[model samples]
Target: MAASPDTLARVEELTARRLNRTLLARQHLLARSTQTAHDLIHHLVAVQAQESNAPYISLWTRLEAFEKDDLTALLADRRAVRSSILRGTQHIATDDDYPWLRPTVQPVLDRGRQGAFGRVTAGVDPVELAALARKHLTGQTLTRPALARLLAERWPDVEPLALGWSAQCLLPVVHPPPSGTWGRFGATPFVLAEEWLGRPMAAPDAERLVVRYLAAFGPGSARDVQAWSGLTRLREVLERLPLRRYRTPAGVVLYDLPDAPLADEDAPAPVRLVPEFDNLLLAHADRTRVIADAHRRVVITGAVVRPTFLVDGFVRGMWSMTGAGIVLAPFEAITEAARDALTREAAELLRFAGTEGSVSFTAPGH
Candidate 1:
């Protein structure tokens, strides 16, 4: 029998909701979904800019019993090194993984160079500059200015800050220890990625890389993958693969592995505190799958997105705990039950932040 238009619309809504929950469940299992936490950690670290500890929480949620020292050990052993990869932001990637992954995201750095630092270092040669960096950083560590001074003998006019960013971003470089240590201090110093990791980075292989991303943050659209990887060429690559497709209410077409699970939109999502630049929030170009459209501004203002509080799979509000306790300010009015759940979540966040009772919210616009 032919279905009515209203029934068809309802069916589509039901499909999308079911798919959403399935997706979440799959990710929840991705850790155990694979072998050990070590295997997952080899690929699970997300990218962040200045915060060294951000990746810790990202893994903590995904894997059971993940300790800070586990990641620190990867760094010390050269199994992973901190550098710019996905989205052209700092990430901790396996040494073996960086070669291809770094080059895959190189275009982002190249584009930035063309935009800002390209003209500044116009006359200078890339090969020559890379050599200079490799030499100075080979046997020792140096801050940006110190390294820039070493280059100044050749390129006298280049800005040290811009030059340093170019070297760190464009090249395989790691900001070595003490920089990432919990209580350590001082300006961060860098080491070459190959030197620290004990091998040269690999060439780009799009198909393999795309498959890995699917495993990590899959069941997404082409744009979502592009946003996560900072590689815009993914549309052509993903289309070539045999992926299942679905239409979202917003008219965007979503793609995913054929066998991946989907979560129910109506599923009860616990109150969870996600860190700044978490893959959950930043991995998608269109975030309606996790965050609602209207409350977007409350989560992200300019370049900074507050680490948010989630209740029932939607962002109900923003949260922070002063010396008093955790405080939550909703973007719009929520139910009494949701408020209680958010308060309980706030307490958990306070516990994570090593604090006591959750604080009360200030009056709006205070």
Candidate 2:
């Protein structure tokens, strides 16, 4: 049975470490899940895919036995899709989730278009542009540049880049396979979502969006949901939902599904090599649960969230793959135990990446 709102109102106060453990459990970072790549993508609602290899690396770290082919096959089979959704950025969502998820987050895309191309698209009919874009993208895929030129032919006065981006934000278009496939890289191409998936998008539902967000990245505040989805005014929506609430040590109210399990604050956390643009680092407004403010500044630099290694469930350093192999750059010195753990995790990452190289470390902050 669901807990009554009255029962839920006696809010529990969650310590920061408690929030950290719960987040790790929900994200499957405390332990790699046995779930398949497709199901994990759906449960996540969307996997950040700004970098072509990001989704692959993200899944590799979270799944028990994930291979590059595990996700590559999904894109090839049309069971997964890559498009702009959460925060108006590139993400790979399951075919079933995209139909509804895209619509739910459409407002964010619309707002992005206005902020980016509203002035450039002045005096241009957005509805007409969207229709024409859909028509061009109906049965065939076109690269962004090609689509831009085509749209410019109709509105000769507008900037081609603006026109292309405007169309992208206005229409539910997707980048087909090879666009987001592992080890693949190139200019992004688009096809109408309906044409690509052979299904129409469902109507937007903010309520469902909130529930999914909490499931994956929860015990979060309204601000966190808004931050993650790039949609605002969620507090009202949150108030109407049947979620249980808790207070942070700072007195901030956090909402979660009534049945959701909270991990014990003392639960052990393994070292993890989180990928760049991974949603785990971007999902919450108050990121201190998973990363310290000082470490965050080093990990996130003006739109780029560098790949990081976690120690004791918190970010301890940044890492990257180089010709020399995996390089670990810690912000501060780590204990010998943490160093040994990171070394082992790094070796596994190399094997998963299918690369031959040695793992090296630099002095703190180097």
Candidate 3:
């Protein structure tokens, strides 16, 4: 049960460092988790997987002994799926989560479709388009381009790309395996979430969604939930819930599950090499808890958020793989101890990536 809002009047206050450690602890960055990839995905609710290798790298960084096959097997068995959810981005979520999660975040997808394709599809009836798309997508998978071409059969005057984009946003669809699998990339193929999972989507439950958010990325504000979910007007929802409250140093109200533990601000934080678009950096409205404002600019440019390395539980630099090995690019100078730790982690990452070479560092801002 949740506590009443009246009980939150004397809420605790949290520092940025405390928030950072809490985020790291919940994300399993402080220590690798022994849970299977499937279970980890469930705990996370969903992992940002816009890039093929992103989810693999994400699991590797947080799991005790994750293998590429661990996740591959989940997709192969249909225990998990890749779909556009939460902020209308590609995410790999457990099959159990996709049903309710998709419906919860459907508004984000709907708004995305409208903004991107509404003009081209101005004259098309969304209901008719969705029905036709369902007809084509029910029993089989079709690549976006192929699906667009098919949609064009009925609406020749409308832009094919718009029609396809609309289907993707308007319907609860998912991209099948080898699409989100590691080292594989190609045209995105789509299938109905219901047909693929053999279950219908559940109704949106904002209360459940908020509780899950607090579990994974909590001690956050209403704006944080809205930011992560791409939904608006969540303040009303937050107020009615029985949640423990805390305020940031600057007085921003943050919410968390009543029983969720807060990590000690002085707890030791391990160096981490997270993948591009990892939710850790994007899960909150104010990211300063995990990344500095100056560093955020360099790490996130326009649409791309570069894979970053963490030192003392905060973004210290960006990293990428080279044919030879992993390359680290620090935004500023790092301590000898931090460098040594990063080098050792990089070596382990190389082994996991099945690459051979030495870890190297580039001059700052490279």
Q: Which model is ahead, 1 or 2, in terms of lDDT?
A: 2
Mind giving the per-residue lDDT tens digits that candidate 2 earns over 1-366?
A: 333556545779898899999998999999999999999998899999999888998998899999999998998888999999999999999999999999988899999999988998997899999999988887899999999999999999999999999989999999998887877888889988888888899999999999999999999998899999999999989989998889776667889999999999999999999999898989889999999999898889999999999999999899999767999999899998989889999999889888899988999978
Listed in order, each prediction's TM-score against the native is: 0.84, 0.97, 0.97
In order, the Cα lDDT scores of the candidates are 0.67, 0.91, 0.92
Minimal lDDT window, size 10, model 1? 29-38
Rank ordering of all candidates by lDDT, starting from the highest: 3, 2, 1
Worst 10 residues of 3 by lDDT: 1-10
Better of 1 and 3 by lDDT: 3
TM value for model 3 = 0.97
Candidate 2, run of 10 with poorest lDDT? 1-10
